[model samples]
Target: MIKLGILFGGRSGEHEVSLVSATAMIHAADKTRYRIVPIGITKKGDWLLYDGPVEKIADGSWEAYALDCLQKDPARYSIAILGTGGRSLKDTADFIIPAVHGPYCEDGKLQGLLDMADIPYAGSGVTGSATAMDKIIAKAIFKDAGLPVGPYVPVMAEEFRRDYPAVKARIEAQLTYPVFVKPANMGSSVGISKVNDGSTLEAALEEAARHDRRIIVEQGIDGIEVETSVLGNYGDLQVSCVGQISYTADFYDYEAKYQNEDGLTLTIPADLPEEITAEMSRIAKEAFLALDCCGYARADFFLEKGTNKLYLNELNTLPGCTGVSMFPLLWKHSGLDFTQLVERIVELGYERYSITHRG
Candidate 1:
C-alpha cells in the first residue's frame, strides 16, 4: 500500500477550512490502498504527526492530542523527521496530498519545500500554485492567453497606504460601481468585499490590504457564477461538466461559503445552452494548460447576464475537497466518485514525478 501523507491545518486564514477539507478527504480515501499519515500544521506554523480520531481534526482538538504525544515521545512525533539530510518527508510518505489552502499553503511556498525534499505532492507545481493563487497575476496570464477576463485594477498595499486618494481615484476611473475588492492571494473569500459605490470602496480596500500586499478590485460581473473541474497532466487533460453557484448573500463571501450552508445552492451539469457549456469546458482546459498545472484544478467563470459573454474568473490549483466544495462535486457529476477522485489525483502526482525525474 502507498504511504500517503495528508497535510492539513495550514498557517493561513483558511486554516479551519483546511482542517474540514482534510477530514473529508481522510474519510473518503481508500484505506486499503493507502496507509494514511495525518500531518497537521498549527496556525503558529508547528507541524505535528497526528494519529487520533478523524473527528478531532475538524473540531480543532487534534492539535492538543498531537502536542501531548510529542511531549511524551518527542523523537517519534517530532516533524523534524521531515527535515532535509536524513529521514525526510520522502521517508515518511510515498506521496503527499496537501488538503490545505491560502497563502503559505497554496501559494507555492509549501510546494517548493516539498520539491526540494524530493517529495511528490498532488496538485500543481510551484509556478502554477503561485500564479493561480495570485488573482492579479492569473488574470494577466489569462488575458495574455486570449481568455476573456473582466475589467479590474491592481493596487499595491504600499501605494494605497502612501496615497489613498490617488489609489481610489485610479480604481474609480477604471471600474464602475459594484466592484469586488479582494486580496490577490486569498481563497475561500477570506478577505473579499463587494463595494456598491465609492462611499464603501475605501473600507473594502482597507480590508483587502489587511490580507495581502497585492490587492485587486474587479468590476463585478452581473452574471451567473459557474465552475468546471480539470484533471490530469499537460498532454492528457479532462474537463468535467460545468456547475453553477446560486447564492443569496451580497456575494459568495466567507460566511456564505462555509458558515451559512443554506446561503447558496450548487447546480451540477448547469442548465445552460450546449454551446456555452462546450465553450466553458474549452476555456477551462485552456486555462489549466496556460498555468502548466498538473494533478487537478477548478476553473471559475462568469456568464454575463445580458451579453451572454463568458469571462475567465480564476483557477484554483488546490481547490477545497470539503463535502460542499464544487471541485469534487463537478467531478462526481462527471462520473468520478470522491474515492476515485482522490485515487486519480494520487496517480497524477506519481505520473508527473516519474516523467519529470526520469534518469
Candidate 2:
C-alpha cells in the first residue's frame, strides 16, 4: 500500500480551516489503497504525527482528539518519504498530500522544504505557488495574457512608509471610489478591505501593510462571485462545475467563510446560463495554462449580475478542500467523490515528480 503523509495546519490565518479540509480528505481517501499518516503543524510551526483520526483536524479539535499521542518536541517536521517508500516518515512516503493553504504553507515555502527533502508532493511548484499567492503579480500576469482584470496599482511598503501623501495621491489618481485594498501575498480574504471613498484609503493601506509588505489597491469589483476549478498540467486542462458565492456579511470575509456559517450562500452548479458557465470555464482553463499551473487551482471571477461581464478575480494555488469547501463540492458534483479527488492529487504529485526527476 502507498503511504501518504497528509500534511495540514501551519502558521497561516487559515490554519483552522486546513484542519477542516484535511479531515474531509482523511474520511474520503480510500484506506484500502493507501496508508494514511496524519501530520499536523501547530500554531507555533511544530509538526506532530498523529495516529488517531483526521476528523480532529477537521473540527479543529486536534489536541483534544490526540491529547494522549501529542509529542513533547516537534523535531520531526522534516520527512524522508519517497526514495524508499511510505513505511516510515523517517524513511519513505510514496507521495505527500499537502492539504495546506494560505501564506506560510501554500505560498511555495512548504513546497521548497519538500523539494529539499526530496519528496513528491501534490499541488503547484515553488514558482507557481509563489506567483499565485501575490495578487499584484498574479494580476499582472493575467493582464499580460490578455485576461480581463480591473484597473489597479500595487503599492510597496517602502513607498507607503517613505512618503504617505505621494503614495496615497498616486492611488487616488488611478482608481476611483469603492476600491479594494488587499495584502499582495495573503489569502482567505485576510487583510482585505473595501474602501468606498478617499477618506478610507489611508487607514485601509495601513491595515493591509500589517499583513504583507506589498499591497494591491484595485477598483472594487461590482458583481456576484463565480468560481471554477482547473485541473491537470498547463497544456491539458479541464474545468469543474461553476459555483456562486452570495455573501450576507458584506464581503467574503473571514467570518463569512468559517465563523458565521450562514453568513453566505454557496450555490452549486451555479444557476448561470449554459453559455456563461462555458465562458467562465474557458477563461479559467486559459488562465491556468497561461501561468503553467499544475495539478489543480481554483480560478474565481466576478460577474456583473445582469450583464454577465466577467472579471477574473484571482487563482487560489491551494483552494479550500473541506467538505463544505468549493473544490471538493465541485468535483463531487462532477461525479468524483472526495476520496477520489485527493487520490488524483497524490497521483499528480508523483507524475509531476517523475517529469522533474527525468531531467
Candidate 3:
C-alpha cells in the first residue's frame, strides 16, 4: 500500500476550513489502497505528526498531542516515522496530499518545500499555485489569455493609506457601486466585502488590506456564482459539470461559505443551458491551463443573469475537498464518487511527479 501523508491545518485565516477539508479527506480516502499518515500544522507554523481521532483534528484539539515528525537537524526534507520500542526512523513519503488552503500552505510555499524535498504532492506546482493565488496576477493572465473578466482595480496597501481619496476616485471611475473588495492573496472569502457605495469603500479596502498587502476591487456582477472542477495534467484535463451557489448574504463571504448557511443552496449541473455549460467547461480548462495548474483546481465564474454572459473569476488551486464541496460534488455527478475522486487525484499526483521528476 502507498504511504500517503495527509497534510492539514495551516497558519492562515482559512485554518479551520482546512481542518474540515482534511478530516473529510481522511474519512473518504480508501484505507485498503493507501496507508494514511496524518500530519497537522499549527497556526504558529509548527508541523506535527498527529495520530488522534479525526474529530480532534477538525476541532483544533489535536495540537495537544502533536509530536515532532521532522528528522533531527536534517540536511534534507524528511519525516520521522515512529518505530517499535519508541524509536523514530527518518523516512520519506511515497506521496503527500496537502489539504491545506490559503497563504503559507496553498500559495506555493508548501509546494516549494515539497519540491526542495523532492516529494510528490497533489495540486499545482510552485509557479501555478503562486500565480493563481494572487488575484491581480491571475486576472492579468486570464485577461491576456483572452478570457472574459470583470473590470477590476488593484490597490496597494501603502497607496491606499497614502491617498485614500485618490484611490477611491480611481476605483469609482472604472467600476460602479457594489464592487467586491478582496485580498489579492487569500481564499475562502476571508477578507472580501461587497461595497454598495463610497461610505463603505474605505472600510472594505481596509478590511482587505488586513489580509494582504495587495487588494483587488472587482466590479460586482449582478449574476449567479458558479464553479467548474478541472483535474489531471495539462494536455489531459477533465472538466466536471457546472455547479451554482446561491446564498442569502451581501455576497458569498466567509460566513456564508463556512458558517450560517441556512440560506445556502448548491445546485449541481446548474440549470444552465447546454451551450452555456459547454462554454463554462471550455473556459474552465482554458483558465486551468492559463495558470498552468496540475492535478486539480476549481474555476469559479460569474454568469450574468438575463444577458447570459459568463465572466471568469479566479481559479482555486487547492479548493475545499470535503464531501459536500462543489469540486468533488461536481465530479461525483460526472460519474466519479468521493472516494474515486480522491484516488484519482492521488494517481494524477503520481503521474505528474513521474513526468516532472524524471532523471
The digit string of per-residue lDDT tens for model 3 on 1-359 reads 88788899989999999999999898989999988888888899867777667888888888775643234323332334333222222144568899999999889999988877677899899989999999999999999999999999999999989999999999999999889999999999999998999999999999999999999999999999999999889889999999999999878888887886686899998999899999998998988999889999999999998899999998999999764578888988999988998899999998998988998
Best by TM-score: 1
- The Cα error of candidate 2 at residue 359, in Å, is 2.7
Query: Native-vs-model 3 lDDT?
Result: 0.87
lDDT: the better of candidates 1 and 3:
1
In terms of lDDT, the best-performing candidate is: 1
When sorted by lDDT, best at the front, the candidate numbers are: 1, 3, 2
Give the lDDT of residue 172 in candidate 1: 85
Error of 2 at 179 (Å): 1.1
Off by over 4 Å in 1: 81-87
Clashing residue pairs in all predictions, respectively, total 0, 7, 0
Query: Can you list the residue pairs that collide in candidate 3?
Result: none
Cα lDDT tens digits for candidate 1, 179-279: 99999999999889999988888888889988998999999999999999899998699999999999899888888888888888999989999999999
RMSD of each: 1.2, 2.7, 3.6
lDDT against the true structure, per candidate, is 0.92, 0.81, 0.87
Question: What is the TM-score of each predicted model, taking all chains together?
Answer: 0.98, 0.92, 0.94
